[model samples]
Target chain A: EAGVVQSPRYKIIEKKQPVAFWCNPISGHNTLYWYLQNLGQGPELLIRYENEEAVDDSQLPKDRFSAERLKGVDSTLKIQPAELGDSAVYLCASSPRASGGASDTQYFGPGTRLTVL
Target chain B: AQSVAQPEDQVNVAEGNPLTVKCTYSVSGNPYLFWYVQYPNRGLQFLLKYITGDNLVKGSYGFEAEFNKSQTSFHLKKPSALVSDSALYFCAVSPVYGNNRLAFGKGNQVVVIP
Candidate 1:
């Protein structure tokens, strides 16, 4: 089965420019997540979508970051006026729906590496 | 709040030698623990998980983790290290009642010298 797919394996932009990252989760997976990873740091959850509704986004930086998952299939994460601090890898992951109170392991994408100057 | 800790930033071992990476977690209730590995220029891959049952959970690439409930630690171990096994390892955890949100440690880079 195909794992989560992310576009533009890499991106380089100047500070203040806008950037966007796209992700397509594995088929039949009902949960999607976006995470940000800095150097030597583990991926941190930015947003989570159960279908088209974002159920968890408390960790997302609302000042310049926004995310949307339309039709509950593909997702997009955007950062306007990107800052150097925004440079990091944007990862997308997915998992099957939880059943009977059991947790499912997540499958991750190759991730989009973004660099801001 | 839940958290994970990888005390060592890196672990070095000779090929064919045994290796271990330490991880400790803090959470309420029965915690769900996991280990993930990341290769250069690639995304993290699930190594293994401990939900219930056996304290020793085996995972991909001949890696295994021992869950010590009393110590609040889940340490990843391998009987024989391989040069190909060199990568970044992360320990993640979620509370039993959490909405499946994972808290991860910074990560431990494993170096298997050939």
Candidate 2:
């Protein structure tokens, strides 16, 4: 079985430019998530989706960050007018479903490294 | 709110020796814990999880974690460490239900000396 897939494994953009990362989760998975990992740090969740609905995105910077999971299979995380601090690895993950308890394991993509200069 | 804490910033162990990486968590409800490993330039890989029942859960790559409810800790352990085991390890926790959001610890970098 194929694992989660992400595009543009590396990205470089200037501050104030727009950047987007794409994610295609494992087929049949209903829960998708977007996370950010800074250097020497663990993954921090930016958004979470249960199908097409974003159930949690409180951590996302609403002014510059936006995400969409259309059709509940593929997802896109976007950053408008990016800041240098936005430079980090953007990771996407998916789980089979959300109805289960929080113990469910999430499969992760290789991630896209975003460098904002 | 749920949160995870990995006390060590780095752990060094010689190959073939035992290894342990400590982690603790705080949650309002029953805790659902997980351990993930990340190699250089790669995303996080699931190592193990503790939901209920058994305190000791074995997972991929000969990795195991002992869940101590009394101490609110879940430390990753390996009997015989391998050089390949060198990587960044993260501990995550979440409540039994609600938002289903995961709270991750800063992470522990493991270095296995060969």
Candidate 3:
């Protein structure tokens, strides 16, 4: 089985520009997550989706960041008016189950590295 | 709020020697601990997890972690290090009863010398 897939492995944009990242989860996976990883830091949860419903998005920056999983299989994260501080890696992960049990090991995709100048 | 701590920034070990990476976590209730490895320009790969059963949990790539409730620590270990084992290792935690949000620690870079 193929692992989670993400598009545009590297992106460069100027400040105040808009940027978007896309993700495709593994087959039959019911849960998807978006995380942000700053340099020398671990990945932090930005949003989580169970099927088409976003179950957890409390950490997402609503003022500039937005995400959607319309079909529940693929997801897109958009950042409008990107700032210099927004430069980092955006990762997408998926799991087979939604119960969040120990068996639900999340598989991650090669993240998209965004550089905002 | 759950948090994880990986004390060391980097660990160097010779091939055929034992490898260890330290991690500690803080959570409200029972914790679900996990370990992951990331290679250069690659995604994080699942190693293993500890939920309820055993204190020692074995994971992929010949790695294992010991979950200590008393110390609130889950440290990853490998019996014999290999050159290919050089990578960034991360420790994560989530509360068993709360939302399944994973809190990750700053990753530890493991360098295996040949």
Candidate 4:
């Protein structure tokens, strides 16, 4: 089976501009996640969706960042008026099992690297 | 809330030698620990996980991790190092009952000298 897929592997934008990243999860996966990875740091969970419902989004910056999973298969993460600090890698991951399971192993995509100048 | 810590910034090992990357985590109840490897310009790949059974869990690419409840640690180990194993490794943790939010460590860069 194909792994998770992401679009626009690299994106460059000036500060205050809007940027969006898209993700397509593996077939039949039920859970999807969006994470932000800063330089030299591990990924931080921004949002998580179980089917079409966003089960976890406490860490997402609601002021500027928003995400949507229209059909529960593909997701889009958008950052409006992005700041310099928003420059990082945006990663999307999916798991086959339900949420809260210890056996759910998340498969990641080749993240979209955003550079805000 | 749960969190993870990778104590080392980088680990260097010669080929054919044993390799180790240290990781520690903090959680309220029973913890679900995981290890992932990331190559250059690639996504993170699942290596292994420790749930409730044996402390020693084997994973892909000849990687294994030992879960120590007493110390709250899960360290990745490889019996024999290979040049292709050079990459960044991340340790993650999540509570068994919460929203299944994973907390990841800063990641450790491993360099295997050929």
DockQ for the candidates, in order: 0.66, 0.81, 0.71, 0.78
Residue B1 in model 1: shift from native, Å? 1.1
- Candidate 1 docks with a DockQ of 0.66
Candidate 1 structure quality by residue, lDDT tens digits, A54-113: 988999999999999889999999999899999999999998883323267989999999
Interface RMSD after interface superposition, model 2:
1.1
What TM-score does each of the candidates earn? Answer: 0.97, 0.98, 0.98, 0.98
lDDT of 4 by residue, A7-57 (tens): 999999999999999999999998999999998999999999999899889
Among these predictions, the greatest lDDT belongs to: 3
Chain B, per-candidate TM-score: 0.98, 0.98, 0.98, 0.98
Worst 10 residues of 3 chain B by lDDT: B94-103
lDDT of 4 by residue, B15-103 (tens): 99999999999998989999999998999999999988999999998899999999999999999999999999999999887768889
Q: Is the docking of candidate 3 incorrect, acceptable, medium or high quality?
A: medium
Model 3 over residues A1-117: C-alpha lDDT tens digits? 899999999999999999999999999999999999999999999999999999999999999999999998999999998999999999999998876543478899999999999
Model 2 steric clash total:
0
lDDT over C-alpha atoms for residue A89 of model 1: 96
Q: What is the TM-score, restricted to chain A, for candidate 1?
A: 0.95
lDDT, each prediction: 0.93, 0.93, 0.94, 0.93
Better of 3 and 4 by lDDT: 3
CAPRI-style class, candidate 1: medium
In model 4, what are the clashing residue pairs, if there are any?
A: none
> On residues B9-97, what C-alpha lDDT tens digit does candidate 1 reach at each position?
99999999999999999998889999999999999999999999999999998999999999999999999999999999999998888
Identify the runs in model 4 with alpha carbons over 4 angstroms from their true place: none
